[model samples]
Target: MHDNLIVIDGLQYSNWNRAIFEQLKSGGVTMVHVTIVYHEQIRETLLRIGQWNRLFELHHDLIMPVKSTADIYLAKKLGKVGIMFGAQNCSAIEDDIAMIEIMRELNLMIMQLTYNNQSLLACGCYEAVDSGVTRFGRQVIKEMNRVGMIVDMSHSGERSTLDAIEISQRPIVISHANPSSFHAAKRNKSDEVLKALGESGGLLGFSLYPFHLKNGPDCTLDEFCDMVANTADLMGIDHIGIGTDLCQEQPISILQWMRNGRWSKEMDYGEGSKSDADWPKPLSWFKDSRDFPNITQGLQARGFHDEEVAKIMGLNWLNFLDQGLQAQKV
Candidate 1:
């Protein structure tokens, strides 16, 4: 059961409330990389970072900030969910490589090269063309590797991802991504890219967003399990893990921001029923964080052994982080 396992969620953008923390505890999550910034939210990103810091202090019993792999293990032993602060967009640093070290000191462990749009550092997957990582992006990668922060390529353009992998002194992570072979979406990685990542010692955390799945909103837990299974078959279980990408507690306003590439957009539920009233109906897949157990059950039902399930659940991620952190030291 997930109860005795080190459950680590690769990414979550929840509203960060006591209720969500309770769900994390109940779900037995040992660590979660909570994304702090996105593409359109370029403005006010620092304010949001402060908000998360305050939440970590206020919810110290339920969560603790993780600056390194050792902190993660310590938090798990102390019965707290390790909150690894991550940036979905490097826009928070604006044009300063020095800020990377400052943020690293603040316990930001993961930094996504790009969001859904192009930035000064790299082109996003949704960009009109895959321009790849820029000159500054290469320097940024080196700084991140030198400072012990993990480089994340989840929403980066394919060319940019490849560039980062080639330039990084440490292995990077596609912290939350699906295979383009299964669903040819911009958000998914191509088979060639996946193989290259595995060969480079990088890990791919399979995502669980309905839009990224081949079946779309009608996707069942079995479909999600199959996606991970197929990825494991290709990358080996050691290089695969879960990256649910659940944004359950976020408001519809945030969703619109994500879709339209703006930070503060109004909600739009075009002539349809809404689920939580706070979010649109299309977001019904994220009913609550408590649904995580269903994923574990689905994996078991699909015949994944306890050890394999444990690796997919969190150990794989932890191992990757350990390697990445050690690489930074070298």
Candidate 2:
């Protein structure tokens, strides 16, 4: 892997610390969209932003906040990792359309309409029947488009994801998920959704979460690379990138929080497996952020040309965000 190549992780939710920042720097990761909230309400989401601000203050030399694509370049030039905030669910804005631009101003650049259940915006992948985009969801998407906050449907259902693509003038993203054909996990997308995404100029970031992989943690680099190749043929090279979904060094409580949130009285194993009570074993090939280069090398070995490998590694993400992150011209 070339050190000069720009690498951007489309999504990650690691336990933030100086060490993780150091790992990203060592991996030559130029930028990452870090998950700031899954179920946090407006106040709690603000607190999360405040917490990240503190992390920035403490590790200013190793990491910096990325408010734009320009910051990504600056981070790479300075050898620091750029951290951009994302919300894994719509809870951050919490029923208020106006909060979209406000959160964007606070640097929450990406947000999903749903996590794994119905939300005010859209139906989740786990739902029995998808309602598609709600009235509130339509308004929110428009506001998000105006303000440049990305609409993510990584955990949303098929109808809802397709609805979002059709409704939004700007291209949305699936920040982290795989194709259901590759693995039948509820979190993965179908070929129909992938094709629509490619047609609408949307991007899909491949997930590395164990459950989303074909064989979970034991999935080999070759297997993973093959999946990428297959997806590229389905969605085209420009619409795919790495969004490893790496949740490193988090405690069990956090997993419980992500899965259950506040709605469940009983434990809700998101994938309906009791074994999901604990984090699935991490992939052996990708133990941490420092292993990002392994993905680039795997793509190369899987017969991706240098340019295509660069696209899958990070260039696709950067180019997609270049337009999507900008406020719509009225």
Q: Of the candidates shown, which would achieve the greatest lDDT relative to the real structure?
A: 2
lDDT of 1 at 36: 81
TM-score of 2: 0.99
Indicate the worst ten consecutive residues by lDDT in candidate 2. Answer: 268-277
| Candidate 2 structure lDDT | 0.93
Model 1 C-alpha lDDT per residue in residues 1-330, reported as the tens digit of each score: 867788889998887799899888877888898888775233566677788889988999889888788888888799888888788888778888888888787677788988867888888887789888899998999999998788999988889888888998888999988999888888899887888788888899877766677766667777778878888888777888888787876776676666555532654332122553343333234355566677778889999999999888899899998877543555
Tens-place lDDT per residue, model 2, 168-229, is 99999999999999999889999999999998999999999989998898999999999999
TM-score against truth, every candidate: 0.89, 0.99
How high is the CA lDDT of each candidate model?
0.80, 0.93
lDDT for 38 in candidate 1 is 73
